[model samples]
Target: MKPFNTGHEELVHDVAYDFYGRRIATCSSDTTVKVFDRNDSTGEWDLSDSWKAHDASIIKVCWANPEFGKVLATCSHDSTIKVWEENIREKQNSGKRWKRVATITDHKGPIYDLAFSPSHCGLKLASISTDGQFKIHEALDPNAIGSWTNIFETNTLSSAPSRQLQSSFCLSWGKSRFSKEYVVACALEQSYIYQRQENGKYTQTGQLPAHGSIIRDISWAPSIGRGYQLIATACKDGFVRIFKIEEPVTEGGNLQVSLINQFDDHKGDVWRVSWNLTGTILSSAGDDGRVRLWKSTYNKEFQCVGIVSAEQKHDAIED
Candidate 1:
């Protein structure tokens, strides 16, 4: 992988990818989200299109409906999440370039992360903010332009009556094969599982340590069936911890969770951990500026996968 460093001399807050992994979106201190296209022929990503997304640093970008093609949602330090579409009409008709279509501004603080519900849910999306609130939006509205509806909100104070958990530095949704409502993971001192009930209320279903330091990221394991599925929590403690939810048949089917695995290979803070679509391979990146890969096995340890530093690797190879 090549670094498409812009030489902007600013820190990049986050990066996001479309479901297919062919397109990537990165929000930067430069206040813009740059979209890149991965050229399989050369194994290189080319800058395809860009949008001046925010007045301040752009914090995060999420694919709103990747299944529909060229649709995205981005959040920024400007306290807003905007839905954008790409019009590749010129590129499709003339076989040349892709472009961004629209930007819908809706939110109150820096949006840290977002997720579109599984493909089955269509254009629905959920976004979280540093203001300690999470919002769900339709992403697309035919009747009105740049319109959004807030379906859920979390209190900012840990002491609030509605606050089952405190501030969230991260968020993730569980995609279990059996369960219907999506399980939302809130990252903080005491993490919580917010399960959307049929009555339209989110109830705390479970809680975990969430993180040793701050939970920077969380990933849900691909579900198999009615059995227990796992979730990977990436900590600021330089490790990724995996946990499995077990429902005991004896205790009236109560759920029991246990830490199943941990990857303490990173020498620095582990910022994020993502599982491939198949849940077979795992990739992690962190403050060390290194990306490591892990696999599913009884080994119970994550090994060095790939490092992004070319000069460091070249020196090690030469030595």
Candidate 2:
């Protein structure tokens, strides 16, 4: 695989691709977010815009679905999350095409991760932070999408270690409009699922069980055609655990969850787990400096299918 340079003065924390993969957003500990657009003629990625989006290290950057226009959200150690928009992308103007549309600073601790809800879920943003806090903001006005309201907020800290030395908070939105709108977030060693209630409030419906170590990250796979939901979680125990969750068959039914698979191939703290667009394959990044891919076999058993390392001078390795 070919790599493009992201020129940052400090270590880059996250890189996100736009909905159509036409643009890339890279955020760094240097507190700047750079957007690179793919040049159709040259077949190269060119930096189209760069700006200081935060006063502290940017922990994560996520692109909103293109249906919401060219929007990007970044969370930082500044204890804030900013929503940016590039409304003038179709124009050739060289000046920064991106603008900060909204700034959310309701967190008492550094924000670690944020995700935009699926396009059908309306314009919503969910975030988790170091102080065991979680929040979901919605842009209710179709005319003025820049304005946001804090519709849901909660603190997950329950007598756990007050301070964390690493990035431990993360959240992901379930990609289905058929069921209730829900988000899964991690705090301390527990992962909780918050579902939107009939009262227009989100409440914790369930918690994933058997995770004893600190969960570093979590992802909810898109269950496009699947009958059930799959969630992958990476933890400090060096295991990437996959859980199969059954949707509520009846109104107000409880979620049925079972441990489907767990991989210890990382042999160290697994930092992140992400699913492909189709939700057929899963990828986990770890302290091993390698990314491992997992796929389900015909027997419904998950298997490690590939590995990619970022080490210098090392050729690619696969199984």
Model 2, span 263-305: residue lDDT tens? 8998999998999998999999999999999999998889999
Q: Model 1 — which ten-residue stretch has the worst lDDT?
A: 92-101
Clashing pairs in 1: 79-109
Residue range 61-145, candidate 1, lDDT tens digits: 7775455666777677777666676666545223233343445456665667777767654356677666566666663553342
Alpha-carbon lDDT, every model: 0.65, 0.87
Model 1, residue 186: displacement in angstroms? 2.8
TM-score of each: 0.80, 0.93
Report residue 21 deviation for candidate 1 (angstroms). Answer: 2.2
RMSD of each candidate?
4.9, 2.1
List the candidate 1 regions with Cα displacement exceeding 4 Å. Answer: 6-9, 90-107, 139-146, 156-168, 247-255, 298-319
Clashes of 2: 0
Q: Which candidate is the best by lDDT?
A: 2
